[model samples]
Target: MLATTHPQSGMVATSRIHRVVTGNGGAAPSRGDTVELTVSHLTKRYGETLALSDASVTFKPGIHTILGENGSGKSTMLKILSGVVSPSEGTIALNGRAISPRTPHDMHELGLSTVFQEVLIAPHRTVVENIFLGYDGPLRRRIEKSARAPLAQALLAEISRFPIPLSAPAGELPLASQQLIVLARALVRLPSILLLDEATAALDYADRDLVFDAIENYAAAGNIVIFISHRLEEVRRLSDRVTVLRSGHIVETLERDGITAERLLKLMAPEAAIHA
Candidate 1:
């Protein structure tokens, strides 16, 4: 049984058998224990615009940061990985299996989840409903509202530092809180490859720390966390490896020990550095 205290009503909502990850026991390989995902020769073109050009990278079970300036194709690469857009060329492999995910649902079904900069939640729905949006079984079928609360509450508690009311409408909450809901929704899926595209852009200091802590814990549990942030400090603090992209091309892949804000900035904007 799953249960959580509703903030507004102080009532406990109960549920049973929540669908999280759709696999055997939903256990991912342990952290630092194996390679999880790989993207090879990825390219994306939007008419005459080449957003990402022949980019390739491998991800293991840890935090990996993607650093680049605007127009550097960082977002483009993330979009392809999240199945929001199809890559113009190249292939993706998950756990040694070549796979093509054509939609966000496809990616999630394959254990790839994403939280973008934009908060994508149904404002009018309760937080619990939003958290288990695409989940199979009872949650998706709307079989029993009582059976969804416990798992949703457990999942949210795992990722968020603050108390969130399971019964509150998401649209009524602040932007920061909505973003947290997005994170909660992603975590509930128990994805093997988690993509964060400027996910903390709207968060406050405390909220950001909470999100980071959740991310670290998630990665430690043997999953891949792909982070995209313009904040060099965040990249330095969270990344096990940093990949620099410039003008749609990969410039370098640096181990955590070798990553520095100055070096990353230089790689991200070579022309600016040269002028400076």
Candidate 2:
């Protein structure tokens, strides 16, 4: 268990991570956990404006990218999946179980974690605290308390390129580190479905590559990663399947071998491509 000192309450809180220990001294079962998410006829409306139409798609174990221009319903789709808002009409099924998550916490409990474009962190909190924030789950097969710090440290090392002290205040860190901390928070849960909405915008070339490598490994290990980014190059390099949305509707979904800069631009913005 990692002990976190709350600045406001002055109380020490204990944090726990999910793990399954076996006779071979094996750790949590991360890889080979097959997952599938299916969205059918999902729609969202804000008064008279339809933010998302009747959109439908399925995601398996791998990095699936959502592409679209501004107001193309990409954000709305993610919002619905993350339970930021309720869908006006639709059904979401995970592993063949129908679910309607009413809040982000609800979604988190259902094995879905999201790292939005916004950097969410308690500025005055320590790195360790922020990484394991809101960690409330079933204490089944919990690891030894003494081993928690090293686990947190290992997760940070996997995502961040630099050495961030566990005791350092999160607000004192740079934007890149802050973003990484948010990413670490999401990954700490070992979610079955990880949503990244422009999560790498704050990272530079090298740091982005490191995080990308981690994401690829996570997906390759039989987990689903929903990646949303406007950067074409990043999508080209990271996406195994690309879903294009335009005007609140899904335009197309292209496989890895079918993606191209020109084709993507045309699908995302045909008018802009014509003018150019």
Candidate 3:
């Protein structure tokens, strides 16, 4: 297990930082615990509109941020990755093996879970019920019925300082609390690859910090987090690598050290940068 010190907090981040060295050079993945997710020539279209075009990037076990303005194909990339939508062209590979995820559940089974920007929850369901909703399948539940509440409570406590009642109807809770429930749902899956599409948008500062901490710790444990957010500060804080997209096309992929507001702006919108 490799221990890392957070640049901002100066806290020793520990657990296990799993890394894999690629051609671009990063760290080597530990014995038997390596993951490399590659998207090759990924393209998506909605009738005449190209939402994503020839976008390709690789993600290892760390925080990878996707940045773009509205309609810049960030969500489309995530949608394809999360199996919410299929790519019109190209392929995705995990550990050098091709994978075509037909559904979100399929991606979940492949150790990828997504918390989309939309807070998806059953309004009438209890908080615990909402957290553990998808786990209860026709065949079996991921956690036993008795075990679900305790796990949900523990996860909630870990993610939020504000206490949410286990039995309270999720619809009655504030939007922040509801968003937390959706996050807990993804976290409970313990996915090797977690796709967060503006997952923290509804969170308050404190809760967002807590969630960021959780994300760091999760990545430290040899898992990959593919994050998409419009928040530049959040991107600067959490991104190990960043891919900038514009008008459905990938502009550039930057290493952590290369990330800068000016450079990112220039890459994302050259004409605007020129005018500015």
Candidate 4:
């Protein structure tokens, strides 16, 4: 995947920093982390089906949307990125480092967090507890409940449009708010890389608005977010660059200004689209 570079992005080398590498290279360079992620020639197969075929892409400090139809390998790519599934062929690098994560835990350690379409959250736990389930994994807690409560509240304030009671059971929340909670939990630790795989699919109009707000706030913190969705309108509004995939291969990546619904719809479903 070709790495994208921006003036606000690149390695921040200071007194303690010895090496730095910028995102000017086609293949992400190793050293300073101008590029947050790099994927090359990724391929995956399930039985006789080719889930991904020679696909590649990169991640920078902004929002990027992966546009595709059902079974277009968007989820497969996300699994590979989150380390839930292994690519048959490819290499993914982060922060000038290459990794092959065999499980989600590996990604967590890399400061990469994801909220899948299917919720992995515990239903019976309170909202705050659910949000901080793995807080100990990322950082040591000095005062478990006190430290976590305030942090979760602050994160919810930033990401959630409505104030949900922290002590409420997770199962009692509506599905839309639950989805937001999942996303909020992912962002609570301030991960450098975040992935949302069809997260807003189950949301209503109002819920989608809430989700978009969190996504924008997440990106504003100098982090990279991978938004995999079929909604063209949302993708257009949220993505900095749009990456289109068909039959498991990358078709093109259009800059936000260089795109429109007609153009994107055509690229997304060329034969079925009726152009003006």
Best by lDDT: 2
| TM-scores of the candidates in the order shown | 0.84, 0.87, 0.87, 0.84
- Pairs that collide, model 3: 16-220
RMSD of each: 8.3, 9.3, 6.9, 7.4
Tens digits of per-residue lDDT, candidate 2, 1-276, equal 123343335554322223311221214433333578999999999999998999999998789999999999999999999999989999999888899899999988777899999999999998877877776446653444455556667777777778888888999999899999899888777777899999999999988998898888667655679999999999999999999999999999999999998889999999988887
The 10-residue segment of model 2 with minimum total lDDT is 17-26
Cα lDDT of model 4 by residue, 77-108, tens digit: 99999999999998999876898899988888
Off by over 4 Å in 2: 1-32, 138-146
User: Can you tell me which runs of candidate 1 are displaced by over 4 Å?
Assistant: 1-35, 137-144
TM-score for candidate 2: 0.87
| RMSD (CA, angstroms), candidate 2 | 9.3
Ranking by lDDT: 2, 3, 1, 4
* Model 4 bad stretches (over 4 Å): 1-35, 138-143, 274-276
**lDDT values for all models:** 0.78, 0.82, 0.81, 0.73
User: What would the per-residue lDDT of candidate 1 be over residues 190-263, giving only the tens digit for each residue?
Assistant: 56678999999998887788678778756655567999999988999999999999999999999989998778
lDDT by residue (157-222, candidate 3, tens digit) is 778997899999999999999999998887766667889999999988999999898888778666
* Sliding window of 10 residues with minimal summed lDDT for model 1: 15-24
RMSD of 1: 8.3
Off by over 4 Å in 3: 1-32
lDDT of 1 at 256: 84
